[model samples]
Target: MPATDVVSWLATAYLSGMNDELLGDIINDVQHQGDTSEAMYAVAPHLLALSQKSSGKMALLMLIHAGLISASSQSQIAVPCPADLATEFQATNNLGRSMVLAQLAHNHEFDDFKYLIAALAGFSGHGRFGRLIEGFDLYQDQFHHALLDTPIDDER
Candidate 1:
């Protein structure tokens, strides 16, 4: 992707309303068609664009958790969260917050982290039925981090 295209994508993605249907399509593509070499790369720019905001981050994380890409692959293609996001989140609450941040920061393993993603997706941008959008931002990253620390086998 060219720098100009990236800039354009970022603006458009950030400004647009959350599109669950679009996200679902992208997720399906990554989950089903990800084996193809070109598919992931083709979908990466959109995923990268969505990663800029909390709601989009939820979608991006869903892709990661669903085995869309390896950690190294994601690092190569997707945008990294600002370094300060980690530090800032970690400092807020030790055990809970650190675990969430760690999970997201190290989202290479494929596991059943979908519930967390779904929860965020459900409440992202707006609460149930699009009612409460204000406090959603407060728990955004913590929600992002919630499944970050899970062990792939400890499905307890």
Candidate 2:
């Protein structure tokens, strides 16, 4: 199976679970996904650059999925952040974190560009060309995030 396929499967699994704690397990995943020379030497810098404006949690995920940006694997080479990518991912809602995680499941495509685009279509209810996120009303209730562990529940 392709990496994207694996990730799409995993994403379905995660969405089925639908909780905040699920975020943490995935957060750890971002920190340790790649450990190759190709990862270390070629990809680390780009990851770091993408993470510049991200929050700590968001940055970590971008780092893990963008390629590699670990201290042990910091490349002397600089990966240029392109000035002309027509698509600009901004974290207006949940950001692109989930989309990035979805990318990791597939080792086939360099990233989950396809899934990200699809999910984004679902999120905002619009395709990259302009179609809105479909099925928005059907699954809009906390996205089932409410089923997750709560602090009040921990008191029990």
Candidate 3:
């Protein structure tokens, strides 16, 4: 599918309010088996524009997805992003950073605030921290156990 079509669908879904199934479909269309497609880069500007409009769940999801696509393009197994796309992607990342920073400045009460933080980390060029945030759920049990097992120092 063309990037414009994908962006149109995403915009419609965002306007209509997205559910998990729709998010899954969006992810599938943009990234395949953890690999980002050219269309992902192509639609990034649109996604960033939409994300800038709100700090809601759908907007955060779009930012996070764009961040993940940026990360994937840099992975060793992935193809090098085309220079034109890379330039556009970098611009999107800059705008995303500004958006996330503004969101972080506000008192966060939303359930998906952590995802916004992750997007901030990613847009700020800290891919490792971004991945940590994004994958925290996968290791939450182990992390909790580790924290519980750690010895505490009483001396202050």
lDDT of each: 0.36, 0.34, 0.66
Q: How much does each candidate deviate from the true structure in C-alpha RMSD? A: 14.4, 16.6, 4.9
**Model 1, which residues run further than 4 Å from truth?**
1-15, 30-34, 56-67, 71-156
Please give, for residues 1-105, the per-residue lDDT of candidate 1 as tens digits: 223433444355567833565555554544343232233433444453354344445644533322233221232343443354434322322222233344556
lDDT at 121, model 3: 74
Candidate with better lDDT, 1 vs 2 = 1
lDDT by residue for model 3 over 8-123, one digit each (tens)? 67777668755557666767887867666777776667677766665566677777677776666555566666677878888877888887777677637443566676677767
Indicate the worst ten consecutive residues by lDDT in candidate 1.
126-135
Distance from true location, Cα of 33 in model 2, Å: 6.6
For each candidate, give its TM-score against the true structure.
0.32, 0.21, 0.68
Top model number, lDDT: 3
- Write model 2 residue lDDT over 5-101, tens digit each, in one string: 3344335433453223543343334334322232222233333444554444455444444332222222234232234321232222134345445
How big is the positional error of residue 59 in model 2, measured in Å on the Cα after superposition? 1.4
